[model samples]
Target: MPRETDDHDDPTRRTYLRYGAALAGAGLFAGCAGEADPVPEQTETPRTDEPGTTTETTSSGQAREACLFPVGCREFTDPPDSVTTYNMGWADMVVALGHADRLRTNRLTAPTLFYDRFDIDYEAGYPALWQDGGFSKEVFYELDSDLFLLDPNLLEAWDDNWDESDTAEIESTVAPFFGCYNRRIRGEWQLDLGYPEQAPTMLESFDAVGTVFDERARTDAWLELHADLQARIDDRLPADPDPPSIALINGGSAPGDGEFYVLSLADDGYEMKPYRDLGLVDADGFAGIETGQYGLTDYETMLEVDPDLILVHWGITTGSVTFGGDGAFDATQFREQFVDPMASHDVGSQLTAVAEDRVLPGPTAEQGPLVNAFQTELTARLFYPDEFGVLDLDAPLDVPESEQLFDRERVRDILAGDL
Candidate 1:
């Protein structure tokens, strides 16, 4: 749980009030049952640095503001003492900025698998925001975080009870929401749900978070390290390299089940950053699968395309975690569960990747600067073992120090505020 704030000034009251008023005027909130509820008193007098200034100060204290799509401008007094996030990418960003201790709670549980490799003992003690297969607004109120690194549109899309008013009410009474939903492209049916059509890249998003938390120094350090690793990989690849065609799928996919959710390897979201950076070809394109469809295919379909490689997404994190509902990623277990089944099946056994043992574990979609750095290197090794060195999927962190693409000790130092 997050540490409770002593100050009840509610600095964001003015902003949310304006937002709510606009929505009410547009009839967006008309006939709402909670419309009669009185707005909280404005204890903090607002201060503008300049006319039409986005930055301002509340009577309670100095406040900083930053704008990210989906959730427009957000104002907060000082860096958040405690924050809540449903997405692991945002949570990892907070951790990279040396604020893991401030994380109140999050929905994902496998971050520790990556963090622990860098000696980051990140453990969230509170219950997940998601409960009984849906998000719990009561948990949000109970946590009482200073900020929510969550996209409001995601709530509207995932929770039947959540709406624009619910978000506005929380911002007015509690803390403002600041997040962008760029994990993956939502279905076309969900387009009108307020999802941002365009969003910053993963590193760009990290920079915005740095601004919000006043941690530019740490963010800059991580960015520099990221650039160094990317350059290393770029320098090694051939100018006209023929990248392998690959099929990316959920880590939990079982070939024996004959159903698999195929992900886009060339999507614009941060989840595909590593694959894009490596210039891996999307096998879906060859298979006549449309991007963003998130379509499921069977073993026979996989045989038709015959991707050069089959990468299990979230394989590293899901497999590394010692304790989780989805058991860890052990090589023997993975082979038994996924590989052997494919080798035995008539259609699966015929696939080139299956016969050649080109199937391998891949990275998680929810990655920040820290996780991205490691995953990029891991993927590089997985894809081109002859050049970058082999990666033991079961023991991903055990890469020989000489084979490492980035400095592990340096990253640990950066996370420790030694940068």
Candidate 2:
């Protein structure tokens, strides 16, 4: 649970050595829907930097630059006026920085759900870009954007997969690319596509984006708030509580469908933060299950491990459907389909989690800073109700001002440029 935001809950690349050869054969490719959504467009480029060094401010002192995995060092001449997001995570990051107005396009097919939850609306007169399907190079060129906040590897998942060449063209001709979609180690497809083995932490990615947008001061402020949250969470870790072994899975909307998409909790990524920070044991990883990059398993195999709890991850991608239409978060539907079906199944009923109704719905896998904070808080309340107060899933949190995990006022002020 989280406070009703005046705004919202809210809230990459390397190997640059062969830069020239990559650009030579760059050509148009059919777009694909590899991310949670698609972004608009922008124009700008960057200069290389030696690894390890972080920030690189321009000589004019107007711009700031930073680096993360995969994308080496990229400089921002000034804050980007327009940006496109390949997924909701990046969109949330931009919104967290008070630049939702800068978004050229995005992948949010259901903007009403998000905008209502976060209490943010794009500035009046700014049109929205919804990538219900995949996006193309032609659209990028037409948009003439100032920045592309997307993960390059996701382009490989597209119908006309973008290679290193296409990426180079976009950087040289359009705006520089940032962000990583493979942070969550879902299955083996990412391995074939050469997704980064190690993804940056949520905070690390935020810091890098903040630098590129010349929003470090605001980023720092948010970081401080997150730090306070971590402190509060630490204080609430129940003494000697049985840390439940949980299986993290992604399922479809169908009940009888045998789809069980389990993510590797062992791998380091932002998606695993809630599990890790709250001290949940990884049932699949611990059972030595050979989980592929994005492989699937039948219900029979899943019952072998018999985890103490089942955490269903939902609302992660644009392909994901919110049952019952706009502004709908159907817990009843979730229980009837995802939780109950598995629990009632002969194979699944034997599991400890199922017997106790311990299966729980998790936050959207495409979480950013604000969402992460809320998810973490929810997890804490769920797992340690005695240590942390009980949370009403359907209602906003009632944390007092003194006990607030984050400074909402600070975030609003920062977004409004009042700080």
Candidate 3:
């Protein structure tokens, strides 16, 4: 299902109290210096689809069947020389296609970030060193990444704060990072202004990054996972399953809990096509409000419609729903002060979905390979349950043991932090 627009700018909102620390508690990151280059001339190339036999040797001399980002000493002959990734989505996607040797390092549990672009809760099953506390440190320090594929929002924030020293440190130590599109850019100029029926959906995102990383086939396979999952989901759902007449709360609670931004399949947000694909029908009188990041909705109007499902987009950093706190971002403050208020409405709780509690929350941004697939799978399963066989309704679906970032909680804790 597609996610509703923000009630207000929550991602940029301040959540937890910013306790002044001396780098000891959160383990402040210190830059890593450059090492011997792995691959020579770095260039974007398509992944090899026609399977061929080849062996990749790690720096440690031990080379097992490399799939995704393998932990321990490793090296790559790619553009950035040697690199590890923090985003579990990236790790999961990479390893799923048997290219583990291409990268190294994984999530080192710490704390959650302000907003989760990719689902982190599902990666805690395995052990990773880094987690929350810092934004992208574990990924930066752990791996020898030459190119960092990140959401555009994150990239903009980093670009604003990054200095020559930081760049030099990363380049000398690891490699240059690449900015990945997140479908959430400024309204003045950008595609997919957080719309359920606009450009840059997960499918488009996979195609975009997959092109840059030369992992198109891997990406296609990942995308194919969604198709398979969705088909199964469709087959399982009631042939005449009622369309979830949904109205989503922007960043806070539904006015009458009668809003559904859109139908959600993969926790990313809601996409209309998926619903139509599943043969779900909706009322034509439903109104959709577009307000940039904040999906300023007509709450009263929603109550009149009495949608069947209510999708509340909650996390941290929605300015409109701010909690007077001292931290960078505190979801509890927002939840209690703002989000909780909306929860009290009789109709809000009495709506069809409210009675059934069909509330699904998702992260705002981030489109890591595996993360995208997980979202797609989760959403597909939710929208088409019978065919999909009751998938684990969670964010960042688990990658197999052999795949990297299998540890679910580690990723979740890391996600608890702010952007």
Candidate 4:
């Protein structure tokens, strides 16, 4: 069952706060260029220990602490007035919590098309934390968010200039970091930087966010909805499932160049949750292809493997949003760029997946509860058109109300706090 609430007595929040306060009292706020402010002293109250009940303190006092990977234990004095995120998944969670207005900054271009369906203009005048191909320390000070929904490990891994000291400085002076880079274990850098062996599921991560933001009700509703959808799909699935073998590749990959970056269908992360839930087989494993070096493959290797289906990762995002200066994904344009080249190539057209036109757009990895719901349905239709219906590539979410896996109005109500 989904975790509806956290009832355990978490003393870590008070302990961590006291530690920071002691450091602040010592005037050791490093890297703020002598303008660093000390961590504020938090007033706490006794918390109730009851099942299905949260341990949060009064609104005027320190909040109950929540724990997750990378950033272990953290507590907020109140629901964050403003937050900063480096990924769409975290941003979407804030939006789903009806705190879209609290988003102060984002790292990537927002997936506005998906947000538009929920009547959210996520990117309107939103500041980008990344500038000129890298992150600037000054930006963190400038944003001065109440909380940072970012993984500290990622900052250290992505840029050599950022390290534990930098993260500590910001935590002491600006805000606490409360995010995990559990999308997919990119490389050894993450492990070297103390990434845990196991991480929470997408829904679990969402629940933690809810706890921090004091939005447990919204998160609970989402979990219940997700559980219902899971049950529905489970009941409908074949008892003796012979799921299709698929080759998952990045959307930016150019097949004409004979180079493709194959992603794992069996990886342990929220990014691959939908695919794993569907029981889809990984073609890369069968082909003895190594995804270690970023899963680089060529047409000759692909022809040798001949997967049953070819799935373009982040295809849905490209189709819906104009990302990274690339125009929105158009079927004709995609064909011209990917499909047509494969059909014309001497080595590409012979593949079973290409011959059968099984090349389809896959969902994005940066998904929260809201995007995950729709993506799961979209993937189901794409995988089993006979059972679910033929998905229109141009407009993926155009499924009839009766045919949709979940009710749009119900989701809208949840987001609108009408639950």
lDDT of 3 by residue, 1-419 (tens): 12225311233322111111111123221121112121111111213221111123223323222111001111333323333544433444334433444555433121123223343232333323233422444346655455554432332232334333554466567665433232333332121222222223334333433443444345555545555545545456675676566554434343434343432322222222333344544434444433223434444555566766554433323321222333124435444543354467654555455456554443323334344434444444555554453534332333334332123433333233211
Cα lDDT tens digits for candidate 4, 60-84: 4455666555455566667888899
* Span of 10 residues, lowest total lDDT, candidate 3: 65-74
For model 2 the TM-score comes to 0.75
Which residue runs does candidate 1 get wrong by more than 4 Å?
1-62, 189-197, 284-287, 290-293, 322-329
Candidate RMSDs in Å, in order, are 10.4, 9.3, 14.2, 10.3
RMSD of 4: 10.3
Superior by TM-score: candidate 3 or candidate 4: 4
- The sequence of per-residue lDDT tens digits that candidate 1 reaches over residues 70-123 is 454566567889899877888889999988888987444676666766666555
TM-score of each: 0.81, 0.75, 0.45, 0.82
For 1-419, candidate 2 gives per-residue lDDT tens digits of 11111101011232323321132123111111122111110001111221111454444347566664445457677788988876666677787788887887644433433455456776322233323333467777766779887766556444234466777788899888877663353333344333333344566567678888887677777667677777778776866768678777754433356656665455545666776676676775533565543445667767788787777765322223334444445556657777677676777777788888887776565556666666677677766777776655444244556545566677677677676
Cα lDDT of candidate 3 equals 0.37
Q: Which of the numbered candidates is closest to the native, going by highest TM-score?
A: 4
